[model samples]
Target: MDNQKKQPKPWYKVWWFWILVIIIVLVLGGMMNDSSSSSSSSDRKPKAHKVSPFKRTYKVGQVVNYKGYKFKVNRVKYFSGNSMDTPKSGNQYVICNVTIKNDSHEKQDYNEMDFQLSANGNTTDFGEILTSGNYENNTLDSGSLDKGATVSGNLIGQAKKDAKLKLEYQPSFLDDKTINVNLN
Candidate 1:
């Protein structure tokens, strides 16, 4: 044996081996992080969004086919201030009854945001009327419709007493064929 102890293996001599080990460790670490990240997402509640699968090309009385659902504006009614438990001065309520029938194979969800109201060509959202206590209980409920099921509800909004009003029905945000129902 040499008087000097055998020199330790040079790092470069095992460079390829170390590189392979490092690559494996990094790959496994990334995989572990991926699983942890996905789990974290599930720990929080996801935000909700509305989606429409088609355009609005149907008239008020015509059956509007959208994303495997059929919608028809049955009728529109106007209510004066004194007619409700709460009265509003110089303003009236325009309520449109829409009949929605899901024609798809699965259930479909709907909410007040799906319907928009226009007064004298000015657009209004469901939240605007909802904030007012006058039309609180009369508004439609957001719910899911089973396949071939039908649900009818009122979409209520406030408008000027003499305003020319219309209800715009959008089945999804991506749709362009928004059906306009004249409430004049």
Candidate 2:
């Protein structure tokens, strides 16, 4: 036999083996982290934000300001088949004359759905009734208000007879402060 002894392979010669080992370790570590985070997240509670603007209630025929926009509910009238676009039998239509002014410098988009009519603790949405020659002027249909501009229209909703009604006006769905107009 020769005097020379056979030496083991160098670390660089097995570089592919070491690379596979490192990849496996990293994959296992990522999987473990994902599972731990998911489990802990289920045990945590969501944080609540403080409401800042829900401190006051407004009345009808008064200018209510919210987030720099001004709103006013002038008058509320009930019509029972009196007009050509009145509600169906056993139902009545409410016409709320309203005016909205954009006092801020920026243009704000207004949605008619934001105005809800609450009667006897139940809320009803504004409805578009068939009126003579488009008698119902819906200002919110224009979409946006310019700076220092005013718009006036009638908000129509269906309700029952002699129901205690109130108009809820909020600048946006995300806003907490709502102006309630007693229309009874």
Error of 2 at 170 (Å): 2.8
TM-score of candidate 2 versus the correct structure, residues matched by position: 0.63
Task: Write down the RMSD of all candidates, one decimal each.
Answer: 11.8, 9.4
| Clashing residue pairs in candidate 1 (N, C-alpha, C atoms within 3 angstroms) | 52-172, 55-177, 56-177, 56-178
Give the poorly placed runs of model 1, Cα more than 4 Å off.
1-59, 83-89, 127-138, 174-177
Candidate 2 minimal-lDDT segment of 10 residues: 133-142
State which candidate has the highest lDDT: 2
Per-residue lDDT tens digits for candidate 1, residues 1-184, read 6698878888767778889989999999999999999888877857575443243344457677766877788777776645333325677777777888999999999887988888888988745344444456566778999998988877877888888787787766885667676667
lDDT of each: 0.74, 0.76
What is candidate 2's local distance difference test score?
Answer: 0.76
User: How does each model score on TM-score?
Assistant: 0.57, 0.63
Error of 1 at 168 (Å): 1.1
